[model samples]
Target: MKKLFLSTITIFILIACSSAPTKKDEIKTVKVNAAIGEIEGLIEEDVYLFKGIPFAQPPVGELRWKAPRKLAPVSETIKAFSHKSKCTQPKENEFILDRGVTEGGEDCLYLNIFVPKGNVDISKNNYPIMFWIHGGSNIWGTGNSYDFSKLAESQKVVVITINYRLGPMGWFSSSHLRNTSEGDDRSSNFGHLDIIAALEWVQENGNSFGGDPTNVTIFGESAGGHNVLVLLATKKARGLFHKAISQSGYVSSFSEQFASEESELSSAKVFQDDIRFLTEDQQIADYLRDMPIKEVFQRYKQADESHLYSISPISIRDDIVIPKEGIYKALEDVDPSVVVVAGTNKDELNLWYLRSKYFYQTALNLGRNLKRSEENLKSWIKYRSNIWRFTGAEEPLRRMSKSNQNLYSFRFDWDEEASTILGDYPLFLGAAHGLEIPFISGDYSLVPAYARPLVFPNESKEGREYLSNLMMQYWANIAKYGDPNTFVQDHRWNKFRIQNQNYLRLDSPEYIQMVNDPVDADEMLKTLESDSTLELKERCLIGWIAEMNFVEEMRGDPPFDFCSEYTSIDLLKLRRLTEGRD
Candidate 1:
């Protein structure tokens, strides 16, 4: 039943820091002349850390729902000592641990930089710049949540993480705002524009921090991954980044008309329905621009609760920012020189599956029904996760391979979790969504302290450390040389192509290898239909999930012939009933 709400409720808490590194009482600070101003940073744990450097003027008041504007140069040395406020977002569920700050102010267009503390000759050997984008379904996340010190210090690379507008503040399409806006100001993707502004800042000031701006790599997971795909497709982002890595990203985009007018749940319709007093287009635009930050957020929250939409209509197909042809079509015409890597976890949907009552059941004192639920859980996860991989990773790479041959794919399958008295964490969680983040960041402490023992027990430390180090090496290598196999000797990761579809299977040392198998949505659905292990209800459920997750073109008429008997709403109600939510 929870699967029905997966679109709206599935929040990808991709990156987080358990705690900041302990700082020495004696302050050790470094100064660099950036494009914005003379910036002062501190040296911590063998890395030079600069925090909360504004890349753009705050999108407040009249700037709301408008494109991010570049910050003017400052003469005084900007003290980048602490992170700025996180972008405004709703408080996450209490069950989610270490989700940085839940609520923040609107003045959040800031970025942090982590550089290797060294005296390298910049003219001779500048490190590659790695820009990170965080994920929270594009609605709830703060770049301040991530600490890239380890990645920077160990990899000898410069890493920058930035915060952008979230939810309705970041993306909104309305005729009122559109008519009043001009040029890039007309773009609904303000968050995307913020990223571009940050990149432009890096291009101008990276050299001051011993980073090679010409070798910038943009990488992120989930919604961040989705943005990376958008940058790859959008012509406006050309030359801003040299390489891209999208971890578990899908190329989902909405038409401008759909976002603004066509649907009853469109951003414009929702706003109009809520604020009926404003008659003139100019009056509406002025009122929205002058609206209080808290009021704007309240309206967005109310609309979200009433409509039950998963994410706001983000990444609109605006001809200026995104091509009218859409993300997939634009990707096919991307710059061939820009190298790309796309991948997904082996059990991408297990995180949600374990939480759903349809797959798992928990009692008051007696724990979850693991033994009875194991078979059905595995079956459902296998097919549903494959559908995720197909839509998010495989299909996008297949389409992108048409123009850019320098593409790679991967599947993270590290599931060495401990079996605790409460339940089998390995069987339930496996290599679930966003689990690969710790590996990439080289921060095993990201696993919550309470669940640390169960998720990463002491016995699994050796293999865990090995895989984490390997994944970091792969990511660093890609940033430096646009290939994960450049420095790593463990395995030769091959390029992904339509004819010879190759992808790296990331796991423990023994299980890591290059896989060449390729399967499409139709093949997967056919296999699911023929599997006698799944009952008719199970098949229908899987079909419904596929229909929801898959792109419009990939969705079949009814997904499954048998599913025709049940409407989508009917299945949703059934799921709700099973979960005791209805």
Candidate 2:
């Protein structure tokens, strides 16, 4: 059955591929001179589709994470054929596509485009563009993991997606350590800078491919969503994207790795843990700085496995790349002109639950105490709720979606009956989190056909078509008019509750219901905050954690002070009072 499904989907895709317009019929693939390089792409259907376009110089050899340099111009007609290399992966424990699917390197800074077929007679294809940033917790995922064929075929819009550096390669920080000696400020957000470089490339060169460089919409799910939000907050990204959409990933609380004190502690811990592997103590910083990236990368590649939330990146210290307090202040001062669309899955932390079950039970049964797991589970809950809150509040003056920023929120409860991936925990983790992925990407075999997200399941062509149409339409519509309502395809997509709200709830299909009244932001957030605080039951066995040397806080970094202040009776600061192996 699986073979049949794969065969069918393969055939379906090949059929689409065969019919795609060739260079003869496709004007977009013209052998034109570009600012960066001379390349040849195909005019597919009515729009030009460019594949394997390099936005920056390959970060190979020593340039890895130094910063993305411009790809030198190729005066010859370069066939921009297959996907560029994928950004370095964050050591995966599971496989998504295939065992062979595991491939990446430093030279992975390439991007792809799928423009809707349109006017061949027109001199320039000025269609509105949507730039997709793939989400993988800034780790293991790719643009190829998704297909934009449906969007291209239906919306007639231009879509572009890119692969960026991941894990330590993408976000390792060196600032705020009180060391300005070697001075590399851009190291932390080099990945983001890569995206900006891509945008600059698009703005200067997208006209040939039928994209309206001035009208770009940036949207992403999970880590991609957070990246989009961050882009919206950046002065560098201003005017590059007119609107933004963030799904499933938002700033609820500071990700532990992004916290100034915490990020430093994490970086220090990785170095300290690996000290024995080093040849000399004094040369450690110089050696790491001067060593070839491929070597240093190998050493830190599997290092994240030793930590709790491995997908998160340690903060780049304060001085060079981005200042320590810049991001928080940026969110607190987001511009009002940027249109915003944000929401979460019916099960936001689905994968976290997966890790919890696998790692938690395995450790507990082995009598190996798991202290961090207890706190992480709670942090996950707060993180989920914060995605909604951050979109609504933070600043009354700078807030854009005061009910009109075209904000749409939905709870994705497609497969409520799906069993928990864990050993014992069931019922509580239902339709829980990330169950929507297969459906979201239109890949259902990964889950039971019965257990798929509603919008993109195979069972419902009508549902898939409706979702594809609605999602693409709303997205395209927002891109076109700062609003997301298709006269023929969608309902009057209403704005979410922006005045201290719980966000609009999508109870079922065929409904874009109005939020009857505002939800007290304070209450929902309180529940979230109260629930996110660490509890004693999870930490009851880890009695020696506080006294352990590894548990010390950074010099200025406050401990989980909010956890100390939590009002939830269920929460217990176990590390605070318990002093022994209780």
Candidate 3:
């Protein structure tokens, strides 16, 4: 019976693949003479898509760990029909919602372009350009994961998505390597340099695709959001983009000394330990450059297994890619005309908290006791997510508003999932991290298949569509006019000022409005201490995780040391032992 089932599934998959529309038969081909070369794209449902167009040479072999090199002009026609391989990174766990390809290659420096077929005339050369940066903690993500066709066609703008190097290959920092390199290649932030190179390519080729290079807007979520903030802080990206939006981005950067050789846990020190068995001399730079891609990934895995490096450091302050003063101080000195939008979800951490065995449990007979866990779960998410909002969105926008008056802030609170036998997704996931991606892209299919029905049930389709449309309008308006409120007249999205501290509350039509809600460390600490639902150790654990998410300087000294009695690792161990996972 099992063999029969497997055979039936295989046959079904074959039938499905055979019946699907082929590109040559169904898609209408279109050609454009970009600066790099003549390229062939496809038009499907009034949206022209150019996929897997190389903007930079592949960073492989001798080019590994170096800044991306620009592509030379080509007279030949380039076929851009399908996406290329994503950048090299670790395998993703099966259960995560944001999962992508299991394996990626080093030869992944490509980009995709989407243009509206009728709304924007290609001959006119005046549409706004929106550059998307995918976010997977800067370790795992590809430009191919997102589909911006609907967004492009509906908003009448040009959308570009590019793949960059990931993991250790993208942001490694070593003094040995730096001494041998020159110019921008000496910078430790290679991933950021890849973004800048893509932007330069857009400036050179955007006119051919009807996009206005001067009106470019760079936006991203999570690590991409973090990169957006990094670009704003660095002078290297000054004239590349005119507007920036960082959704759920935090201002955390490692000093050059810390990233290189300040401590045993530094990336450089950990890498040196990995290669010590292979070599012992001063020619480490040459040895690393010649190392095979598989071996480099193997060494990274071995180092991670030993816990020599607790977390990967991105956007290093090398005084080349990033300024020495750091992201916040540098934000105040950015161009005053540069518009900025920064925001966070109402319950950002619930995505992780809902899956944890430490806080939730299940039984065979009765379902998980939602009533018993409601208070504790809500309290933990409230305090920690508040800190995330304050550090990620409020603080950065407040500082930037000092110089740039064209600033906007928002809090996404659209949690209207239908209750199902599987679970209460509205309570568990809420407006969690990365949920806003679908709304912005107008790609509701991006929602995980397993939770799609419950999250976007037919009964709630009207509300979900309304909210998604509003978000897409706001995003496109910002790219076109440097203000989200230009076309969204009914909801006058206020500018973020230090005094008013007002932010748009993005929710269903009935709930969406501009509101004032400011968060501070002192208030968060006070609320944590006053809450009686949690024990002393529980409060400490929650406080520690929240504070540790941001940089050291932004984390003001709390009134009480929550981790004084028991460290966060200790609590994790205890939870595992109690849950019988030990």
The candidate maximizing TM-score is 1
- Best lDDT goes to which candidate? 1
In lDDT terms, how accurate is model 2?
0.51
Residue lDDT tens for model 2, 230-282: 67556767778877876664432233345323543245554555544655434
Candidate 1 — what's its lDDT?
A: 0.76
| RMSD after CA superposition, every candidate | 3.9, 8.9, 5.7
Query: TM-score: which is higher, 1 or 2?
Result: 1
TM, every model = 0.91, 0.70, 0.90
- Residue pairs with backbone atoms closer than 3 Å in model 3 (clashes): none
lDDT of each: 0.76, 0.51, 0.75
Candidate 3 similarity to native, TM-score: 0.90
lDDT of 1 by residue, 1-582 (tens): 011111222223233432333565566788887677799887777788888888889888888888888788999999888888888876655333212233777899999988897784332449999999988778777777776778888999999998988777777788788888789988878888888988998998888888999999999888888889989988888999999999887777778887787544466766666469778878889887787766666665565555322246777887878888888888888899999999988877766655456555666221345533466667877887787787678878888888989999999999998776767778777888788887888765555455567678888888888888888888889899988887677688888988888889999888999998775667777878767777776688777667666773333344677877786666655555332232
